[model samples]
Structure formats: C-alpha cells, structure tokens
Target: MSDSNSILFFVLGCIATLALIALIFKHRFFRQQKYLPKRVITPFERKMFLRLKEAFPQYHVLAQVAFSALITSEDYKIRQRFNRKVTDFVLLNASLDVIAIIELDDPSHIGKEQEDAQRDAMLHEAGYRVYRFTQIPTLAQLRKTISG
Candidate 1:
C-alpha cells in the first residue's frame, strides 16, 4: 500500500476504536441506571427509589406489595387553612389517613428539624400519619412495610 493510504487506514481505525469505547461506556453506565417504571416520577422520586434500594434491601418484597400499601395517595395535594400546602403518602394499614411523608432528605434534613416538624404538623392536622425515612427503603422492606 502507498504510505498515504496506510496512514489514512490507521486514522480510520483509531476513530472506530474510539467510537466503540464510547459506545461501551454509555452502555455500561446507563444499564445500571434504570429507575422505576413510572415516567411521571421526578428526579427526586427516582433518587428516593435508588436510596431505598440501597438502604433497605431487606424490604424489597414489601416494596412490591402494592402501591396502595406504601403510598395511599402519593402526590396528594392538600390546601389547608393552616397555610400548609403539601402532598401525602399514606401507609397502607397504618390506620391513619396519612402515616408518613417519604421525604427524600439530604443535607437539608440534618439541621432543618424545625422545617420538617412544621411540615409534619401540617399533615398531622390534616388527619394523616407521617413516617420520615431519611434514606430510601428497599423494595423488600417497602413491600412488607406496606403489606404488613
């Protein structure tokens, strides 16, 4: 082969190799990034699910029990005279209308107990229960927690 042709072939080979590497990385990275099924769930929701998956693996079975079992009225918007507007998560058998509000807490909850408390009271007065899980509960735990 002529020197020019050989060099061109080498360049093409390098480009192809780089493309393959990029494809591989993209595949490997996002393959594990699959979130839950609901497309409407926000980034916070997905983060919550991921956290739950990580922290409470034992609850995997429970998490799948039923959406109703864990969250009775997810994203339930409430406009109360208390000047507190909020969404609700009702635990299935908790007997309370809203036993928990699964807030995906990060550094915010560390020193913001007051803020959390205010939110809790808003739901409380509205006749609901509240259980704050700093981290996400695993599917198994979520299943059992809601089911049982």
Candidate 2:
C-alpha cells in the first residue's frame, strides 16, 4: 500500500478506537450514577400526617396526593392545569370517596392566597370540599371543621 493510504488508515483506526472508548466510558458513567431514595413529605407535613391519622381514624388520610389522582377531565387544558399540582392531604371515606382536600398553610403559603383560592375554587367547582389551616388543629377542632 502507498504511504499516504497507510497513514489515512492509521488515522481512521485511531479515531474509531477513541470513539469506541468514549462510548464505553459514557455508558459506564451513566450506569454508575443512581437515584437515591428521598423523603416523600417534609418534616412539617410528616407531623400533620400523623395528626390527621390520629384525628380521623374512620377516614383515610393521604399526604402529598396528586390532584390527578382525585380528579380528571375530558378537556386537555383542564387536565394540564391540575396534572402537576399536588394537595397536602386528602381525606377519603370508607368507600374510598374523596371527602375533603386539606391544605396546611405554612410560611411557604404566604402571599399565595390568591393562587390558593383559585385552586380551592377549582376543587369546590368539582364538588370537593377544601379546608385550609395555618396550623394543625386540635382533634376536636379537626372533627368540628371537617364534620360541619
């Protein structure tokens, strides 16, 4: 073979080898990386969750519930609005029917009243009751608020 042809093949061979090594390294890097487990609810939410469970032993108290699980619509736009939104807690009866949507308004909820009202309105329009609290209520208070 001519020197020029031999040199071209050598360069091409080096490029192919480097490309293969790069592909292997990229695959290994991604494979070695993994997602770690995370807490599903915050510390405050955790405390409230326990309280809800204690307060409403007759009903199911679900925390960090996606709105999608509770409601759906035929309109894509309507679905888009709530698909990404999650509720702090959802109370369900023995028949698994949604009784009410509970929202704990911590410091994070400050200045979001308008947005929260809109969300609550949407839930109300869908025939679901919504309860908002700045702090965890006592067991009697919870029963009174929910039952009334």
Candidate 3:
C-alpha cells in the first residue's frame, strides 16, 4: 500500500477506537443514572414553585413539574423508611442537601388541612422542611424564611 493509504487507515482506526470508547462511557453514564417513579405536581404546587424560585434566587433553578414532584436525586429518602419521592420543586444548594420542598395547596389541599399538616409534620419529622407558600409573600418574608 502507498504511504498515504497506510496513514489514512491508521487515522481511521484511531478514530474508530476513540468513538467506541466514547460510546462505552456514555452508555455507562446513562446506565448509572438510575430511574425512579415519576412525581406528579398539582397546579398549586406549580405556583408555589415559581414563587419559591423567584424568592430564593440563590437556591438553584426550579425543577420540572411532575405530578407533585420536581427534581429528585438518588440519595432522596422519606421518613428513613420510604424513598423521598416528591412532586413539585425540590430546590437544593451547592451542598446537594434539599433546601426546601415547595408545596402549593389548592382548594382541595387547603380543605384537607389536617392531611396537609400531617404531611408537613412527617417531612419535618424526617428532617426535611416543607415550604408551604400560598400567597407569594414579599421579598422580606422570603429573606426571613431563607435566612432563618
């Protein structure tokens, strides 16, 4: 074979090897990104999420709205018994620790105040604070909540 042909083959072989390596790494990355059940967020939850994100600009962006769940991670757990699968926005700081669970209470949820309270209690009991924002409070209230 001509020298040019031999060089072309070698370059092609290197490219193919690199492509295979990249595909392998990509497959492993996706494979390790374990999938969990989706969370559903209510309309009220959506509003609350917007307010929270607006209020706390430092706590990362709002997560996707799924049923009552937003963003979740592999380490999320609830009550130390069940997984902390949530709907609505679950905002976090750089630490990866959940900063808040923003829940919006629609008429139904507000009507079932006891149930709401119970859920919040459970979250708090499990060391997860629930940020129940009904009316979008002023920035002052937000600063207080976020700082305190």
RMSD of every candidate to native, in Å, equals 11.9, 3.6, 11.2
- How do the residues 1-148 of candidate 1 rate in per-residue lDDT, one tens digit apiece? 9999999999999999999999999898867755667554456656666655454444431221222333234345533233333332333323434333455565656988887787667656656555666666776765566445
State candidate 2's TM-score.
0.79
Candidate 2, 58-116: lDDT as tens digits: 99988888888888899999999898899999999999999989999999989999999
Would you list the C-alpha lDDT of every candidate in the order shown?
Answer: 0.54, 0.90, 0.64
lDDT of candidate 3 over 23-121, digit per residue (tens): 999998867657677655555555666667777777874554342243233554533323333434667887767777666555556577876776667
Better candidate by lDDT, 1 or 3 = 3
Candidate ranking (lDDT, best to worst): 2, 3, 1
Tell me, by TM-score, which candidate is best. 2
Candidate 2 structure lDDT? 0.90
- Model 1 gets an lDDT of 0.54
Candidate 1's TM-score reads: 0.38
